[model samples]
Target: MGEEIGSDHFTQDDFREFGERLARETTLIRKLQDEGGLSDVGPVIGLELEAWLIDHNFFPAPHNQSFLARLGSEMVVAELSRFNIEINTPVEEIAGEGLARMHASISETMRQCASNAHDDVDTVIAIGTLPTLRETDMSLEMMTPSNRYAALNREAMRSRGGAPIVFDIDCCTGAGEDFTTSYQDVMAEAATTSLQLHLQLAADRMRAAYNASLLLSAPLVAISANSPLLFGKPLWHETRIPVFEQALAQPSPHQRVTFGSGYASLDLVEIFEENLELYPVMLPVCADAPDSDFKCLKLHNGTLWRWVRPLVGKSSDGKPHIRIEQRVMPAGPSVLDMMANAAFYFGVVEELAEYIDAATAEVPFEAARANFYAAARHGLGAEIEWFGKNRRRSVVSVLDDLLPMAERGLRRQGMAEHLIDKYLSTIAMRLASKQNGAAWQLAHLERHGDVHRLTADYLAHQKSGLPVHEWAI
Candidate 1:
């Protein structure tokens, strides 16, 4: 909510200024949510894919800057790490068999990526947490060499009582960034990575997608758990879970547990308002702004809600745009896997938009929230409330019911049946196999507790580009 593109810093007054800006922004979705009758719930869809680069040995490679310079910055963008790269797919409308086209584009991009890295780097694999990730690899030194990232990191850490912005990943190294173990274990293993998927949605459905996102979040995490280690410490199915939340958290007095009062995101208002309230402007503006204005609250109000938020921006036709951007999705096993993730989510949006009352009423928002945390805490093994009486259902059961609903919803949108089946079924298979990225990474780490060894094994599997269950078997 603070800033859409990115930012370098924010002063005390920027908050108040940005807050006022929010009041002035007339987003397209507000028209529908407020007026009710006719709205654009247009079958619009879009995607942003982010991935990490690895060396021939299958470890994080610091090639992002060089690659972007050589290949150009139109498609691939910079990520948190200089070793990481991001691809933004042109916005595609999920009309008819539109999803197929998006899938093909992603495939082509992957091929191009491989071709570009042919001899220079070994490969590029996508997963939530790179199994090979090491504490040394997460240092601020490797952070994307951008003024924006550094500024934001500096300000963010500064706000939280001067804590070291926690660049350390949880490894067996005694949970401290400073070396606690012997010299032999210095580097450990560090190639764990992820593919983050960003989807764009119409504003009216924003609220529905927001809530449903929480419900869908767990399932996606369960399926895409590729991050399972910090240094040598193996924890959580998707170890990225704790790290990501902590990294983006509002940095209040309490950063330990996310549940309850920490984040005031309940209904739409809390989500949007709070996002606008917390995040400091992270982008460095160039010659774009007519004048260099300085106002703390003013900048806060003027900034848009993007990624970690529901954003407001102007569209091609001069109309305002409001979109809910989901940042948690990790990179993939394949384009098919990534598209399936998108499809499953689209189905949820369709179902929720079409039938809001039933979803919200039947499943209390509180229960929905609880289910999400449970799924994240414990992957497929976690139990969920199905019909009634706290009936425990495996992650599979939840997806089984939801996958069909997604398919139906897609069909309702006039999407081709074959496409829906092909895509949604992938999600089903993902849950059934229980060998998602996280699951596979965890198993790999357990087999080879050494971080470096775990990372090497992860690279071996990624080099093969085999499905998790396929690799596991």
Candidate 2:
């Protein structure tokens, strides 16, 4: 979905050819898995953080076109909306100072992006959803100029038989106040941003890692809940989850954005096989690349925005490898906070993957999915069923146990003790204070009763480079 297509229009013949090519590639993937053709790369991690370009008024500034041009860096690129931009970090092996290197790189890139923005644009801020954004701001005119985005909007509407894209969210404001509206276009999906974490793993370990990511999604969303208010109403703790899921709704048996149908088997290719079977081709932009490239297959898989998606990519040596993308967490309160979230994820997933098979058996797939939504709705206050527990436990308690396991996992990966403490301690403090980004935002709005003032204060604290727990509400 990040890549652009040659054209926004597609014909029946294009879909036919793409389907044929996708089937061939899916079969080839199975053959490769059987032949052990995937790369044996150890744990390598990278991230893409989506952020907003805001004006001095604290509203979204739709100037990413000129912003990217002035910045002149490959690390920063345009997103679904003109006001949004994505910052990518280089891949780092999960050992030694890899986490610190990612932190420094993104921090420098953010500084350069903020400095190079258009005069009308204020500094770029990373959040799940900008608090000052208005509903009228999500028009088709605000979409980033790209053939891929245009085609996606067209096909999504086509799937719904030209019905208006309805975004009806139960803002969960406790007074039965709901945010219900319809969009002629898919710009509503653009309103939500996220921090997508990619972990490149060996073919043999991808399954365990993917399952472990599902098991951990609840606690991760709880601790990192950032998007709370949408269009001035107090919604779920992380309203981005529902905003994204409902914004792209279509009349299909399978949802384009979802947790997943089920856990993965030993053969990770089965996940791609489900893509071939369940999902319809939204963009049929056929490629001339060979079957081994899996261009069409990858493009099709990209359309299915699974919360924890399995990816097939090429290593530096040009060998294809498998990776799991954890897409549950939101973009920031600060770079330090985001990096802490990343460190915790990588460490815990590494340790959990060792016994994910047994863990998943103890917790059913439906329970994991339920836990995810529960956590998204309630943040740290959400209670979830943990493995080997007779009753549900609060997300805070679960993290209390998981943090030590994460430290041990980082130690096993040979990560420096200081770096481990530096990052994981942020998570520790967040749990202790019970003040994630959402909690801070909600508290600020309660005290100040002004969304603009809240956003301004949030950005001020973000620029201070303090974690959300330390930010004064």
Quick one: best lDDT, which candidate?
2
Return the TM-score for each candidate structure.
Answer: 0.79, 0.98
Candidate 1 accuracy as lDDT: 0.56
Q: What tens-digit string does per-residue lDDT give for candidate 2 at 199-316?
A: 9878888888889999999999999999998987888999999989888887887899999888887767998999999889998988889999989888998898989998888987
Candidate 1 ranges beyond 4 A from true positions: 1-23, 26-41, 118-120, 165-203, 248-270, 276-308, 386-391, 445-466
Clashing pairs in 2: none
Q: Quick one: how many clashes does candidate 1 have? A: 56
Write one digit per residue (lDDT tens) for candidate 1, span 349-450.
678556555555666656655766566656666666544344566766777777777887788777778898888777777777777766665666556556
| Candidate 1 local Cα displacement, residue 207, angstroms | 2.4
